[model samples]
Target: MLTRILPPPGPARMLIFITMVMSLGQGLWIAINAIYAVTVIRLTPGQLGVSLGITAALVLISSVPLGHLVDRAGPRTIQLWSFLSLAPLTGVLLFVQGFWSYLLVTSVQGLAYRAGNNARKAMIAARVPAGDRARIRAVIRAALNVALAVGACLAGLTLAWGERVGYQSAILLTALCFLVTGLLTLKEAPVPPVPAAAGAAFAVFRDVPFLLFTAVDGLLSTHGLLLDIVLPLWIIHHTDAPRWMSAVLLLINTAFVVAFQVRAARGTDELKSASWASLQGGGCVAAACLLFAMTGGAGLFMACVLLTVGALVHALGEIRHAAGSWTITYDLAPDHAQGQYQGAYKMGVDIGKMFAPALFAWLVIGHGATGWIVLAVSYAVLGAAVPAVVARGARSRATAKVAAGGVTSSTVRM
Candidate 1:
């Protein structure tokens, strides 16, 4: 059973193990950070918001440069240093007293986290076979979700304990997780750095088709905020469903992803299939939005049913979207520049998320069903456009190859 679910004993399995450990730490931090900031640190909600915004901005600013560094310095070496940096940075969170200190610590932590993530993706590109990359990513994501859930449960226990010591302990434990992940990274074989040509450090920015696809894909990725931020508010304020149903919805989404994500990822190794998966996934999410909108003003039983069904559909979309996005990002990038390309993709997603909370609050929570309809339409339109966008990217790559000289077999297929 373990073999069926996990990669064989090799670098891929090692990577998955590292991902699980890292995600466990993130899960603990994410679950309790806001409460710690508000209650322990005595920061107001507005101050917390500012800190988060600044941290995100710092992540955006640092992503490309750090990823470029990963390419030049080697993925394994950069990833080890990034993880080591995170250990101290996260530990410093235990000492945050006010907004400024909190902001400074978290901003640095975010940058280190982004650098580690970019290097990890590049490592996968370097180590995993092309045919297995998407599947392995899906497996890693599944492991991540499971580990995060476990970590969140651990955080919950700390919250229930209701002591300053418990919170501090969780922070220390998360720091330890980072340290362990860094040490574990040492076991993986070293990946050679891809030397970059002078004046071509940021060439990915010039790939217009890739940038466009990243933008559209980033917009679609905002569906996550819908589940995390929008749904809880919608259930509590608008729908007749019980508040606990929100937790239930999250459980359903997590379980479905763990069970089906690898299966959904199958066949996404190719551009055409991956594009189709994105379209289909988008349609499912759009349908889920419409379903969720209908829950407004519904009776308790009817609302519960709609929420359950919508959650399942949303999870389906989530996994498919993830699989397709991984493939597209991997395929679109050149072998030598995977780190920077992945960083660009991460930047796009982060930019979308930065605005998603406010946007969803205004449109979905503020405007109610109307907001939901707008989101549905946006997802559907964007999802339908993926195929064309992918084709255009393929054509552009092909043109570049031909212009350079004779087209490669891969270019001919594109």
Candidate 2:
């Protein structure tokens, strides 16, 4: 377990270190940014929401273009920019007074990070063997969990006293982290030479099977948000469970992710295995929904027990989904156009982020616990389709050659 969970020393391991440094900074920002915004920036809730909305929109817009650049130039160069540009962007937070400055700086900051992350995925595909990519991603994800945990804990000190000083210190620390990581990336992260590519920027859209696969992946990305958003509401409004259970659900998620992500990643190298893993994830989610529904109108102990089981099941689904999705994202991408492919893949995730919250709320909040039944049925249907869809994606991946803005008809799902 230790061997599997711990990344072996190499570029992947070093990459993990870089990931840890960047993640720690992000963790710090996540812990304090909201309070800091309220206290230091004096921004309204509307401004904050709009700023984040614009940031998400920018990321969606840039995903493909950044991927194209990554393919042409190389992921290392893009990541170098991700790290470097963020340093200055983060610094601009100090001067932010109104919505405009906050939006300007935060949007730029978010875009840089998004581009870097998309490039980082390409970089992993480039550097790590396909068989190892899931495990390596697991390591990175685990490290991020650890970093965020530590960062959040440390940020609590600031929360206790010195609100203004604490906010500035935390933001400065975040900026410094980006600077230090950028410097380290420049000095140490080895850049593999990019292979030349000639293809249409929109070639990914032409691959029907890949698009289908990406659609599944995008939906899969919403699993994390379930615990963060949906579960809380369900506990509050639908279930007899206490609101505090939401926090417990998150803790369960983080603990399981840190403990079992690598273990869950095992045997995901092949498309069939990955598809199977994904199916299992969907089933877990389906079962979890049922359990969550059962939490309604139950005795206190039973409701808590049912919710716990549901959350734990959801965590497993999250782990399985992560491993399976990471496998396909790396395995199916054409090496020459990895950046573009990854960018396309990321678009699916962004789609989930942009839409899943609203969709889930409509399903549950508007419809009630019966809405969970609807979700469960849909998840099972989607999960049941995985094997066949994967079989189709496999054929396409085997025969598909992306040429200027489209794929061959042979690559389309049969």
Candidate 3:
């Protein structure tokens, strides 16, 4: 089990270690930042929301350009500087006294985070072999999950202490994590920048099929919001499950991902298999949504059972969706432009993050069971549409290849 969960000793292992450390800080910050903002920083809920929203918008706007920078500057250098930049930005959070200052710090931090993230993805593309990319990504993700859970627990302790010092300690610890990760990144083998071609810097925008696929994948990615934002509220307002069940459901989801993400990624190294995984994963999520809907007005025991089962099903879908998305993103991107392409991929996810919370709140929280049904149908439609979109994208690429002369090394399996 350890061997299966751990990547082989090499660059992959090193990357996983970096990811774990990064995610540990992220988990700590995520769990405590809102509370710290509201309680310690004295920001109103609305102010906090505005700051985060603006930060998300900045990240979305900056992702592609930063990614292009990675392609031009080399992944290692960009990643190192981006990671190093984060330490000071995060440390500055300790001194933010007003909404404007908070917003400024967070916005810059968000862009730094996106840049580092894009560089890391490009590094994976450049360093990892195609056959092992998805599997290694899955392992990294599993490690991330475990590390996040541990970090969250530590945050829980800090929160329990209920002192300003504890809050500051968490912030400092997070900043230190960023610093350490940045320094550790220096040990990674340097990846040379891809040679620039005319009109290549922003070419991802010209790929209509890739854009459509990104949009669809972005929509599918909202399954995360469904789990994190929607389900807890559903349990409270719409179902008879105990309030504690929300935490239990989260535990189940985390445990399942840590255990099964690599296993789920086994067959997704190829586009055909990855697309099928996406479809099947969507179906599982849709089924879970239906199960969640059935929990409304149920007996306590029945609702508990339904919620537990739905969480497990959702976890299965989450792992598969993640595995497929990674593989498809890698396979579809041009070899010379992985950074920009990954930036585009991150843009899709950032868009989802910006809009998904409000959308799910209005849709599921406002409409109750009917909202869940609607969400289920939407996921089903989106999942069902993935194969067609992938097929279309593949055909367009093949056509472009033929026009260029014949199939080249960049051509992927149809």
Candidate 4:
């Protein structure tokens, strides 16, 4: 019965598959970037943090503009360009000597990364059937996480060799992976027609529900960014862990995501008022971050184990949030405005990625552990608050309109 009802694996599935493979390369590249910046480029931790923050900020600035370009040009072009550009940039990293050179190379890499992400998601939305979009997204996320786990292991092996050789090999491998993936994407169909203008493309600002969703999503992204930067650094620098512990810690997080994400999103087949679930997820992440802060003297293995448990809870929240958010976007977006809406959605995501590092860096420097706890608490409060307010407001506004309209009861549009 389930088999009969499920959509055939065709264009949408193929796109997801291809993109997932490409994303594996992206995952591998990002997982070890901090090590490379510190060991190979000879940058201080503070400088590396700032550099990463700046790159992310640039991506944030470029996301909407790139989205508009995708709408005007085509996702295929943008995706292809992004991949090809990454290949050369990774190769050029070998020659980067000074701080100025490092900054220039990283800035370009940021542009490619942002453009690739925007083009990829927009293509999936355009190409995939509406009904199965959420499931497809979940599957892609799970696959991407699994790939990242494998990539992190590989990166560890390379680093075990020596910093310079290891970093060069990883970067080159990533470049090749991008080259191949980008080329395959050339076979993709052109962008589909969107439904309507729905006002200006940027008019997503006027929609209150979307604004709230974007804000929550952006804030949630800080947790994810920390996983990349802070967690591993802590294991390496602060704890009495083996050098390989960073890779092991990542595997735990990715393994949980790969294993449990589907189950986490079991019944969320349609978009509805899910602000409660969103808050729950956010709260879990904030709590995990605080737990992460509390650990002091355990061995690397035990510390990683605790972190893994926290990450599992966090991953569950992440899956639900991803599924719910996409479902909402599909439900709320007017047809012709899908591209614009997607652009708007991505803009919110980028904002989170952009600010997380810079904001957290300052906190870590100024307040130390206390600062970390304060930031965690603040995020937790915001996480729990936004969804509750938005969900309740949606319900009240809906109820009031129904009451004003004479005797009949009616359901609100999700």
Candidate 5:
């Protein structure tokens, strides 16, 4: 990880640093933001939830258009402006008083964030080659986790300063980080050349099989949300495990991801292999789900043991799924339309996030241990089906190629 980042290419390296900075700064916001609003902004939990929901809606609505912009303007241009804009956008939090003010500012920031994220992903995909992209992304992701951990500690320190000042300083620091990252990204190099687009960005929509692949992969990606939302609720309510163990579970997952991401990314550079890896990862999470379900009748010590083991298994799954998803998302994109393609691809993620809370709650929290069993089976089945989906998409591409008397590389499209 150190080696990859140290001598990294000029533009991409700075971009990677920008990612770390973003993660680090937002890391503080992860746990603190809610509390900040409840106390400093003086809003109810329901109000906060409503505001966040609106932001999510806006992001989902804006993503594809932003991607079109990326393809048209180039990632460098969009990225620089997005990051530069975010500094003031984030700083707006300092003046937010109530619901409307918070919503207005945060929603705009969400636009910047969504567009910036789309541009960043496309830029990275354009910068890196197919073969090296997976490992490079793995290394960058691992570094992000480390940066977030440090930010978590920083957040903890800020909270120690009490309510108003702590929240204000954190927001300011976050804004500064965005500003600096934006400035540094100005030096980024041009993306590797591709044939200029002669058609509308919406060509991606014509590729239906690729969309289904995105849907399935999006479901697989929800494992992170499962950890964030489902696990804690399940641990506290369903299992005999102590609530404190939720933190332990997160730590365990983080440790595994940071330690093994690059290693897990190997052999998944192509679609078929990456799809298989996704299946394996889904299977691991399913198994972990069963383990978690078993802790109901177990004693406290035994429950803790089960939770820890299950968390480790889930972490392994996270590593696998992330590696596979990262590779396919980049590799399957058309170079000329990467911005739009990647942007469209992210719709899958938005779908997953939008559905996870209610869907998982209904399956797990509402139904009890049996819910876990159902979830495990469903997750594994979806994952196992991925290769077939990719195959379909690949065959579709091949057919199109043949119709045009053109050729393509052997890699599957999904």
Candidate 6:
């Protein structure tokens, strides 16, 4: 169990260290974003909503093309830029005042980070062997979660120290961290080199099952973006929750990732089993969304408890989904086309972030939780159906190959 959870030494080890540094910076930013948006920027929930929506939108547009770039230029180029550019964009946040300016800076920051993140993940997936991919992915998730946990703890102290001082200091520290990691990534040699011809965007679309899974991945990504953007903003705006509650929420969400992500993602190599795992995780997150809707007017203490439990369940599902997706994605991707598949995967993840926050915000404000509830129900439905679809596709693919070779008459029996 320990060995499975711990990444083995070599490129994987270096990757984890670099990832941890990046996550530390990200964790600091995320841990504070809600509070900063509300308190410092004086942005309303709706503005915050739009800000995230724009960020997601940009990421969605960039992911596919950027993936192709990674294939063409190499992941090293993206990683270097992700690390180097973050410093100025994030540091400038301290100086920005109004809504438009803040949004611009933050969006730029998001785009830069998005490129770097997709490149890093693609590179990691490329380097690790097929059998160990789940464990490697899990290790990366756990490391990020651990970084989030650390940031949460520090954020609590930072807030107490002074809001402006705390936020500026945190951002600066985050920038420094990114710089170090970016330099480290530059130092390391490339483990996988994608073919130049594979640089064409949309190469992964040819695989029907892979494409289908990416659709589900898009939905899942939307829910994740909404949760990250909406929940805290809603709490701060609607309820009189203590500011420290943000740290509590962050801690709850990341704790499960640190503890159980790898374990839940185990045995995702079997396509059918992996699909089931995605459903299970998605169901858990959808249920949590419902629980949040039902619990109205709860004070900070009760909200904290409910959100923590919900977050734990959601994290379990996230781990399973991530593990299974990574496993299946690696299995389906042609060896030469790994970068393209990874880019497509990133595109799917960004698609949700693109529109979900703004839509969820509009629904909640224009309609009510009814809108949120409708979305939640849709999430549950997809959670249930997605696995069956993926499984069927996997089975069909397997059987068609056997039939082409005249090995088996029935798809399932084969």
Whole-model lDDT values for every prediction: 0.90, 0.80, 0.89, 0.68, 0.82, 0.71
lDDT for each residue of candidate 6 in 1-414, tens digit (9 for 90 to 100):
334567657888888888888888787788788788888878988998888777777767776676667666677777888779888887788888878998898888877787787678677766766667778788888887777667767776787786587788987888888888888987677655566543335656667777887877678757665457767766665544665665566566666677787787777766666667777767877777766664346777776676667666666667777776776666655555566677787777666665677888876545545765776787778778777767656675666556556443221221
Q: Alpha carbon lDDT of residue 155, candidate 1?
A: 99
TM-score of 3: 0.97
How well is each residue in 1-414 modelled by candidate 5, as lDDT tens digits? Answer: 456444356655676688888888778777688888889999999999999999989988778888888877888888889989999988888888999999998889889887888888888877777887787788888888988988888898988878687788898988988888788787788654344555655788877887888889888888788778898998888877889888888888888888888899999989888888889989998998899889877999999999899899998988998888877776566667788778788888888999888988898888888888998997899889887887787787777667667777665544
lDDT of 2 by residue, 92-159 (tens): 78888987888888888877887788778887888887778888898888888877877777787878
Q: After superposition, which runs of candidate 6 have C-alpha atoms over 4 Å from their true positions?
A: 1-4, 33-55, 92-107, 163-166, 198-201, 205-208, 225-250, 286-311, 358-377, 391-414
Residue 45 error, candidate 6, Å? 8.3
Q: Which candidate do you rate higher for lDDT, 1 or 5? A: 1
**Which residues of candidate 3, in runs, are more than 4 Å off?**
1-3, 404-411
Model 2 pairs in collision: none
**Cα RMSD to native, each candidate?**
1.5, 3.4, 1.4, 5.4, 2.1, 5.1
**Which scores higher on TM-score, 2 or 3?**
3
Could you tally the backbone clashes for each prediction? 0, 0, 0, 4, 0, 1
TM-score of each: 0.97, 0.92, 0.97, 0.77, 0.94, 0.77
| C-alpha RMSD (angstroms) for model 1 | 1.5
Question: Highest lDDT among the candidates is held by which one?
Answer: 1
Q: Encode model 3's per-residue lDDT on 36-108: one tens digit a residue.
A: 9999999999999899888888888888899899999999999899879999999988888989999999899
Clashes of 5: 0
Q: After superposition, which runs of candidate 1 have C-alpha atoms over 4 Å from their true positions?
A: 1-3, 405-414
Alpha carbon deviation, residue 131, candidate 4 (Å): 2.7
- The TM-score measured for candidate 4 stands at 0.77
Summarize candidate 1's per-residue lDDT along 1-414 as a digit string, tens digits.
235889779999999999999999999999999999999999999999998988888889888888899999999998899889999998888777888998888888888889999999999999998779999999999999999999999999999998999999999999999999999999999999998955577878999999999999999999998878899999999998899998999999999998999999998888888888999889999999999999997999999999999999999998998998888888888777899999999988998998989989999888999999999999999999999999898787778767767554452243
lDDT sort, best first: 1, 3, 5, 2, 6, 4
